[model samples]
Target: MRVDSRTLPLVPLLLGPVGALQLPLLGGSSSASQAPIAADKPLISSPLLQEQVKAENLMQRARQLYKIAELGEGEYNHPTRVIGSKGHLGTLDYIYSTLTNLGDYYTVSNQSFPAVTGNVFESRLVLGHTVPESATAMSLTPPTKHKEPVYGQLVAVANLGCDASDYPSDLDGAIAFISRGQCPFGTKSELAGKAGAVAAVIYNNEKGDMSGTLGTPSPDHVATFGLSDTDAAPFLEQLHKGEKVDGIAYVDAIVESISTTNIIAQTTGGDPDNCVMLGGHSDSVGEGPGINDDGSGSLTLLELATLLTEFRVNNCVRFAWWAAEEEGLLGSDYYVSVLTAAENKKIRLFMDYDMLASPNFAYQVYNATNALNPVGSEELRDLYVEFYEAHDLNYTFIPFDGRSDYDAFIRNGIPGGGIATGAEGVKTVTEQGMFGGVAGEWYDPCYHQLCDTVANLNLTAWEWNTKLVAHSIATYAKSFDGFPKRVEETSISSFAEEPKYHGPFLRQ
Candidate 1:
């Protein structure tokens, strides 16, 4: 960012030891920094922690992040912190460096894992002579090397294309048309390849267009791409009319296996046995800057961690910045999967922060009462509600679906709770009355588009939601008073829902 006229302390000096080096952190007056922070004292309280969360600091951090993503990420510059991008690497480096700079207060580590990374060059579908511009080639799908748009008869598949029986016997050398649901996108592609289809096209069940991934590369999979229901309507009508529908599908992408890292940091001063954990994913979709999608969430955690170094907590507060969440919650799933049953029990609770800021926004809380959650999750959820209600803010409860990074924690029977503004989901008229944004628009109109930059954020919503996050950190760091014991086996049920969201958007 431009350093003209305004010289502010970087992350290290945001609020120096709470008072001693007292600089106007976030433009606060000198007295604001000098308010009761000492090394020997047990500084743990909701108001005290919440007091440090400033809009100016948040705005400053967001601008820095926005600038990082704007200049482009990796080799292709298509990386908005997606796996294997330089931008993703930059985010990891920033988090690790900042936490490590806090002296002995935190134990920071970088855990690396291999993940399949891909960058799409071109993905398009052609019908007759018209090209549907909105159709996006599914990530990791095979690139069709055809120089000219090839023509093949279009045959629509049945039953979501999961079973082999759904394909027709005569569908050879044709494009397999399918609807998204009931199965993984890769499974559909494999089935189509075996059924003799040259390429596959999947359309969204929802109103807007979607971007999808095959999870990883597979030799048996055919070229595939995802489209909106609206874009594929014309071809479907022609096929039903007993008319010819010639199509060409092409996808150009560079796919490979590469190493990626997840950042984990924990305060050393609290009780390790009853550790309180919270985090958000750091990866974005290949399409945009992802500032609101997870940048807002990650920045909130970073700012809190910086402020937290000055305070002492009764229970440990651990923070994680997950990688590859946009590719199916890979980073978090990997972290939880390797934990021994005993190691999992050490965590008293886990809270997630995914999308805390959206252009058209309303406060959203995770449903801790869902059957899939652990016992003490409801109390954490209630605490978030308490914060909102105390401030006279309206909120709604989103389902504890496997769409977010919290999927792993809940499945392992850890108490998980979270707060979000939203992503992709349309705002209801009721939400419109509560938050005053456009009713029929997406909670984030720029959900996964190139438009999701610094200008896309609703700063007022971001400031409010981030303070709630700080309150949760402070409350749980102090004590787990009304929480129940973790006597149950990991969890109630697994995440068996169809069409799991790839980070913020539903993957076909």
Candidate 2:
């Protein structure tokens, strides 16, 4: 998604970027800084001593949970396929089991929300129009009964090219081919509808495959289909010649109740009057166990929850395990939308941990609005750096998007920031030197695949990341003076050019 320039802060003041930092601090050396560092207050002397002790105990318990999850998670079923059809029982059971391990330290409630049902429909231009080897089914199309042949004349429109205004005049009862351009996939489809076209197909203009969402429900009535560049080439070419063509929108639709939830487990003794939220999503794409896609983040949050269960801090810390994040942050959206004005005011911060255990990942911290980290947020990042320095780790910062639960908090004007291991297509060769890995493949090949089970975890990175995350949380809870009343933006673009540091400690 293209964020407006106004929404991103400058580059040097790092925001949304991710990476792996050097670990295992040497004596007198800090993990976050180039030199030895010490916190203004001792890690244990903070007002949240009880909480720190509880957190340490929770870490031990987390080891056991990891062992259990490792034993039970695997590819007996393809990851995506497993989620696609199951009742939410398996997932809920996992949550229940995780909570059971926490004993009486915290309350565990089973909250269920209504499920929005949708179907997957696919179409192809075969025999006549050259068809690609693979295609995606539209998210909203109803099931199709026949796998047999179906055809229709074609209509191609340049939705947003140099001459996008030249829309086809007579497109009724004809298929429409539109080049993927400036507007959203939904917008292209809506345009096709406005032009009186039947089926709509959108193709990528860039070199790689293009993915997008359609039928996003905006009080818009545009029944349309999306296509990859490879899939639309044939029919699109025909339309370029002003010739009629035929195609199919094959669909394998599903009609079931898919319930998603956001687990909010609160810690007491901290200021219940105001709270901090640490979160990550639990649901994965209908592909794999999502161990890495989010299982890493999910597990980290769970571990954090376990650690903070009985701890006492200055304010309440709520660990939220969200569901349906892959579905465009649905679970979090619901949570935020439901909060009252009073409830909104009570929230002081939201820290998101989306992906934090990839061996191939880069370190990133996000601050809301403009890619650069806001000044107040930068101070928090500095504190994190101090933690790293105290532990002897290397780290960097970049621009960010509050694309998770923190987003809701930011939208409501709450302070927030987060760390990510990494995701598809962001890390570069410089990062590879520091983190160690291939330069261009997906951050975690198992991201949304069935292989995202326990065994797939990068334990070294996992342990280090979890520790880093814990340290960050513990510090923030104990030291944050108060939420910033206002944050001035900073420019950080030049920081991107610093020859990404890679020393003996960096690894892929």
Candidate 3:
């Protein structure tokens, strides 16, 4: 995920009014009942299909993904599967080859799209001849001053810098200091540039150090850097006391436009118009092997895709291994953006699975019940919750905000839902009692870190989450059943606009 925790509004509420997820009940959904029935292909049974999910099979693929990262395949063979790297290309090839081998079962295609990809070569923040403060260049925010340092007095922008009036008119050649919140870092940077600031320095609003982005580059954006809240406090105080905080903001990066690909595979056995799409990101962050952050989820989908070939489906099932997700859901966003209204209707649902095997595991269902998702979305969430309840497992719910791949689907009012073990969110004591892991620590301490290798996973959570994934997809494939049929209206409430972030998100 590009942003740590993103929370936005229901956007025009195309799916339903905020907190409303029910469409008027209709007769049996034509999505399944009307499909051609083949006698040789048995109707998908959830338990039977889930029973086929062997731990060894899941673990074997997990190891395979780990090996793909270490094989040093892409251009920047840093042993990480970051986008534009050979490791990610190798990952894409592996998925494509695996699905292609299924013979007539699937029609797999790779769709390429343009995106901004880069590496931060250098980042530093120094104020008034004092010791340098810890700082990082916001990802994809372009290298500063054509790789040259810019020196100026650091001026604090009033408020959170979400508004233009917050910037001082006298800030010519000064570095604008802004707090991060109520708007994107890119927005703040653009505002600063418009105010004649040479650069923008945004400090974290929350307690931890920053893990953020400026989304993609914009013409109005000045070079931008992120500072920790802890470090920003004293400087903010100094500026408040009518003191001069002369500073130098320097960020050197090689931000450039590059092409990335997303792998899409659809079952040939079911209705082509109605598909159940699911998968995780194929690319990882540049920092680590990413086996746990998403390798677990992506590979689990691979495991399910392979196993699904054994049976037939009444509704089409589409699988995607999205690219550039760490760069802010780029691949999935592009996929949805290009689809015609007809294409949007054909996609019955989009279920995103990410971070499914956290070391400190909590079976968190995507909180569709609380979100303003499409009418059928709560049913999708219910399916996962149903699985956990059936097995007598304790689980919780997470917001269905635009934090993952499903952001695009639901933005267009297509039903979306899925399961996750957990991410950087801390495990509560109550959850500690439920899942039995350390309470205060993160669900995955190695999230976005070098330690997120194959060994970082919890096999129990991995297998159980895998079964839940299988159950949800298999159930929908067999029949849309009691699920509401799609209705017709032509407002087209897409994700072109979105709610403000409580965390990081790509600006449309």
By lDDT, the best candidate is 3
> Which one is best on TM-score?
3
> How far does residue 285 in candidate 1 sit from its true spot (Å)?
2.4
Candidate 2 regions exceeding 4 Å error are 1-87, 100-104, 107-111, 117-128, 133-135, 138-149, 158-169, 181-183, 190-198, 205-207, 215-238, 255-257, 367-377, 381-399, 486-508
Where is model 1 more than 4 Å wrong at Cα? 1-39, 70-74, 77-79, 128-134, 146-148, 204-211, 229-242, 491-499
C-alpha lDDT of all candidate models, in order = 0.76, 0.52, 0.77
Total clashing residue pairs per candidate? 1, 60, 2
Candidate 2 lDDT over residue span 46-154, tens digit each: 2343233333333343343333333223433333312323312344345544554554444444344544445443345442445655445444433433533334566
Between candidates 1 and 3, the one scoring higher on lDDT is 3
Model 2 lDDT-worst window of ten? 499-508
Over 455-497, each residue of candidate 1 has an lDDT whose tens digit, in order, gives 8889899989888998998887888787786754754455334
List TM-score per model, in order: 0.86, 0.71, 0.87
Per-residue error (Å), model 1, residue 381: 1.9
